[model samples]
Target chain A: MKTIGKDRFGKIIDKSYFPLLVVFALVTLIPVYILVKISISEPVDVLTQHPTFLIHNFTLEHWEKVLTSGRLWPAFTKSFVVATLTAIFAIFIATPASYVISRLPKKVKYIVILTLFFTRMFPNVGIALPISVKFIRWNLMDTYTGLVLAHLIEQLPFITWILVGTFEVIPVDLEKSAMIDGASRIRSLISIVIPIATPGIAVASLFVWLNSWNEFTYALYLSLSENTLPLQVYYYVNRGGFFQTATYATILTIPVALITYALQRYLKSDYLGGAIK
Target chain B: MKKFFQKYHLEILLILPLTLYIMYFTLLPVLTTINLGFINADTNVFSLENYEYLFGRDDFRKAFSNTVIISILGLIMQLTVGLILALILKKTFKGKGFFRALILTPMGVPTIVSGVALLYIFDTQGYLNELIYRVTEGLKYIGIIASSYKFIPIDWASGGIRTLFMIVFADMWKVTPIVTLLLLAGLESISLQVYEASQIDGASKWQTFKNITLPLLKPSITMTVIIRAVDLFRIFELPMILAGKNTPVIATFAFEEYRLYNNPNISGAAATILLVIIMIFVSLYLKYIDKGEGLA
Candidate 1:
């Protein structure tokens, strides 16, 4: 019986999980491959055929067209600027607020959490009408600052709630230890709590960044002049002519796909506490 | 007073900006909605004329029905499919990790992209029809789906309410993985010992699932449903893109009133109604959550 138990444990450890994992791994790679192939393959080839496992020929014509067409750079800049600014804003706004929530009395904490959940649940469209009207009145429409503010409607609660989870995971003992050492609350938060919660911070920043970057609904309606990369890609997909538009779209997806892939690790993990487990 | 000043100063500082932002953005918007619901745009005086106007309109009633039908259908599709996929993927299987990542791909694609992609696949000359045609032709000899040869090529994009189904399907394709992931998280917390004990008691598969799994999963199921319902309720881009401005989800309808008609008040009225509904649902969901924790 002991030998059987030991053997079972050994089998659990030594069984070739990698071979089992390969099929699923291929499934993930298939879409990435299709997108890349579509981006590089000849327009004729793209139009005449469906996506296959392998490509017959490659062309850099699409990349050339995308670069020379001149919308790519501005769109890229818009997306980057929006994402970076939104991340910074969300993190800065959320950190202190979440910290306060963490320190509040239990009843207050529950109320605040509930409030956050409810407000976050408020569809962007609900406030979107009134908010956009206000933006237009204030001449904030079609601006980066305007888009950033609009994003906050969604980003604020997400960042705060996520950070709250991170803050909660850290025991009070750590903060008390810092207080005993004569460190100020702010000092402890900055020096000890923040460092320890770096992964959580990364997770929060990642969510904010991806959300702002990939967001289409507000960006579509709000930004009239400096269209974000997603807007440009979408415009091409819907409005631009066959080959040129497809090529532009294919070019557009590369950065987003990369960013998404990079952040897949955090996404895979249960970073937010509200997730079922 | 000095001690109070010292102790609460940080709290005041921390909360003030957030409060101000929320007040100006969230609270004010909701209030604006309520205020708008009370007054007519032309009169600029306080009245229930806007509400009466909304309540009286035939299209408004249709829109409400459509929205509810779509939301409920979308929720049911998402939950049922999501739960099944979650269960299927929970057990470790060959290539499970990679398939898991593949399943999550839809989430990474933006909503607008999803709208366009589904449009591409399901349009008349699209891949779906082509596949169906080929399959039907091949299957006719096998006596499967007897009207296989007579199958009409359905143009999904132009199919009014049917397009809503496509929109729901597209959304499900994107969000079901999220639901599955959430339920999978719930599943993770349920120890294998429970299942083992159920098995030892000679419980059948269905019985074990009903008895052991469903009860334990109620909280997570509730969370997923409530969150996803709220998410679907405020849906704008998917239906908007697929069905155009004609598709009247609450959010899109609000957008039209504010943007196209230049009638913020009407938009506000609609939004106010939506806001109250969502808040009520959210409060109930939270109450349940609290109760589950014995906190209420």
Candidate 2:
């Protein structure tokens, strides 16, 4: 083997690589760091000539306003409830649909999967207008049920495809053998298959929850007076002050970041791999 | 009869719930929109007036072009930035996890938060302009680069390409992590043995990457691009928050027609056109990816 300083594999042993890494880490992180800083800093501190990157008189005034704004609690509660219900219903419906697709003939299976993907291409903002009009006529407007229904429609195909990836990996013979041993199909599915697919279920549930929580268009329409957190955030963006908006935005970000950090492991796993391939 | 049920029973039972929901909600609404688009309200008769009106509108033309431009720009930036981050993260080094976490955290930052945060930065009194003012003042001391003109701080929401660039950057900042993760997964799946063999044969790292990794990563890259493209086409919130609901994206254009104009028929026509365009692009991408898969 030729001894050269540049031939290092796996590890970036070169001295220049460290600078690159440092610059990247800073570049990638500094904007968000600035965001959090502005949220906590006093307005005067933020708007000053030097614009203190270093927090001096760190105040919770903006956060306090966001919290006591009276609109925050109702919107948060409504969003939390709707997102939770959407996640559950989406996964519940998607499980069986995915299983059916997983067992389809190979050629037909690919086509069906493509169709599912195609459904995702259109914008919710586009379809939501007519749908909202119909919803009003059907007396489904401004209700959690209406919002959840719309969210379910958006999330079901995605969750189902994810579960399809999970289901496909599971050996058919494991469930088949159980059925042969006198455990019924439903029993085998409930006891054996689902337990094995817990990781995928989590991914699907979180994805659905996050999508519904962050979704703007459908909520914009279906919820006439009842605002979701995203809608409330948009309201603040339009009319609220910089600090107040930052505070609410930061509030919106915390749980999502926590869930993402917690779920980072399974996120890199085969569930997404199944859909992309 | 029993045998037929036995063969198809589980499949039927499983798909039933999803089938019912799709029938009731997705199909029903889509057909409703199509129906709404085709009917004329003024005459109480069927006509293509809504579609013709939509096609003739200046806003529709601007919105269509804006969507296309933003999607293309966003796609190129996201793919390049994502690949660089992915490649850097692929190396084994101390503090790798910390760096990855720092870099990847943006993917979890809510979309509106990213949008709103950038808006703060780009505000007249926000940190972005403040930083520029300070930097330019610092440079003014050197008396070199500051001789041309006085540095005027920018307002990012001034309604131009600058606003588009800022919004695109915000999107890339939040989404590059996702693309990185996807590409990193693809890179990890590559066999180390191939790299080792190439190294032993006296191939350079650049050569190995070009010859081996590039070909192998084609499928993942294509998949990622197609997925991102489809997503970028329908972007709404970023523009909405940054530019106050008037970025002229087709989706938002459709929205304003309904909400501001109270013209659901015209909105329906715009949406239908969007759906058709997306469907065309989706099929083309699917075909291209499938062909790439076949070749590989």
Candidate 3:
């Protein structure tokens, strides 16, 4: 490596946004530092000792408490079930919707696309109340169906819209050739279209999956008997028990963080596609 | 017409479930909610009482005002910081990939997880206080911020101005990466040749950014802002979990009206009003975006 004079290097670095890099790094890292510090600290020390960037004493007691606690595991199981079911439900409903939207006439395609767009913008709170109350009245409250349906409301639009984008990019000729060879529309979608659109499907499924997993409000409102992990986490905080169990909360974040990391590339690509000209 | 219909019939069949689902969840609920808003609870008769209650109420007014303030402030914060992040990360840098990954990790973590994390930091005995104590001790040795004065204990999670600020901050943390990612994509689409041409014409960095970058970015930026605004406006769990019913967002307000207040008509009215605002924004955005793309 060639070394430049100190002043020259300084100027170059400044010009190239050394300051901005530092700011972003600080902004991003501070919360993580705070979280780690709080998580490992003893509940007694959490109050008395000033939170440090480096822990003076480390303990897994909080993690122990969270693990040994019976309620935590059940909630985690519930969240997993809800998220998985929502993903399956969303894919089932959205795949067909995406196919139809992509196959429609140009005008109809535009209309359907517009509908999806509007659905995305419409706030969940607007309908969530009625839906939850309806579920309650229908005795679907605390049921997997209710949670799955609620998640579908958010997941369906995104999955279908993103899938539509994927399908639109595919040349019509491939599917046309398949159709001409006597493959049915369903067959063409399954054998021809889906394989070609796997990347987009991956991106959309990741989004729907993450949305379903992270969903808390509707779960909290609907599942009076069965709480998802997020709802339990909320209750943990509300009940002033996070201090008693910060390690579990930190541990809880690990799976989500890992899955998110796995899905980050897809999300990045999707955002890039939508945001770019 | 027959040929057109035949060609698309299969496609339309696929759309059926989604159409039905959206109708049931989106359109039907909204219509029913609006109808619900017009009825009185005691009489179970149409009376516009719910709307009158909202219009004549202080709590409803507070909720609306607070929601707007949080949305506007949060939007501005997200855009400003997100733009900075995008601009910085657009160029070559060491650990660029690492930073990008780090930035978006929070987005995938559940909202309640984040809310829980914030509570740990902002709680009285939380990390923030610990940091404050350390800083105060250092300040005492150096002579600043009154070494003798105990820092005022303020509950950060209350729906007061401070909690609203935190809500905006949490929202920014959760979403700025997304905006940054989007804006970076927008920035990348602009050819470097255009920038070089502008530079050749003696344009400054700021000038090329303002003239070339901003105009091209308008469409993406507008869409990003509008989409995020609508989504955040409907925010339920974060505010409710973090700030509780004290902080009245439009979404949580409805939840409170129904859950805590036990007034479905009032909740329906509030939800209906919020729904109308969102629809207006969506239609306006559709119109505006189409004008730019010539889709209209």
TM-score for candidate 1, residues paired by index: 0.86
* TM of each candidate vs. truth: 0.86, 0.92, 0.91
- The per-residue C-alpha lDDT of model 3 at residue B221 equals 79
Which residue pairs show backbone clashes in model 3?
A100-B11
Question: Which parts of model 3 are misplaced by more than 4 Å?
Answer: A1-16, A269-277, B1-8, B144-150, B281-296
Indicate the residue-level lDDT of A84 in model 2: 98
The numbered model that scores best in DockQ is 2
**Residue A154 shift from truth in candidate 2, angstroms:** 1.6
B98: Cα error in model 1, Å: 1.9
Can you give the lDDT of residue A162 in candidate 3? 79
For residues B1-296, write the lDDT of model 1, one tens digit per residue: 99997979988798777777877888787677688778878888998888788878766666666677778899898888677667767777666776777777766666565655565555565556666776787788677767535656777777467777878877776676678787887777789999888767666556666788887877677778777878887887777766664557777777777778877888888877777777776667667653554223
Tens-digit lDDT track of model 1 for A1-277: 4443445433553354444444434433443445456567775555643423356777887778788878788888888898899899888888888888877887888888878776777767666766776888889888889889988877887788778778887988998899999999889888988899888888788778878887877786686677887777666665634444445545555556676667776664244324422
Identify the runs in model 2 with alpha carbons over 4 angstroms from their true place. Answer: A1-16, A48-50, A269-274, B1-6, B44-46, B147-149, B285-296
Superior candidate under DockQ, 1 versus 3: 3
Note the Cα lDDT for every prediction shown: 0.72, 0.79, 0.74
Candidate 1: what's its TM-score on chain B? 0.90
TM-scores for chain B, in order? 0.90, 0.90, 0.90
* Residues A163-191, model 3: lDDT tens digits: 87778888889988999999986787789
Each prediction's fraction of true contacts recovered: 0.32, 0.55, 0.51
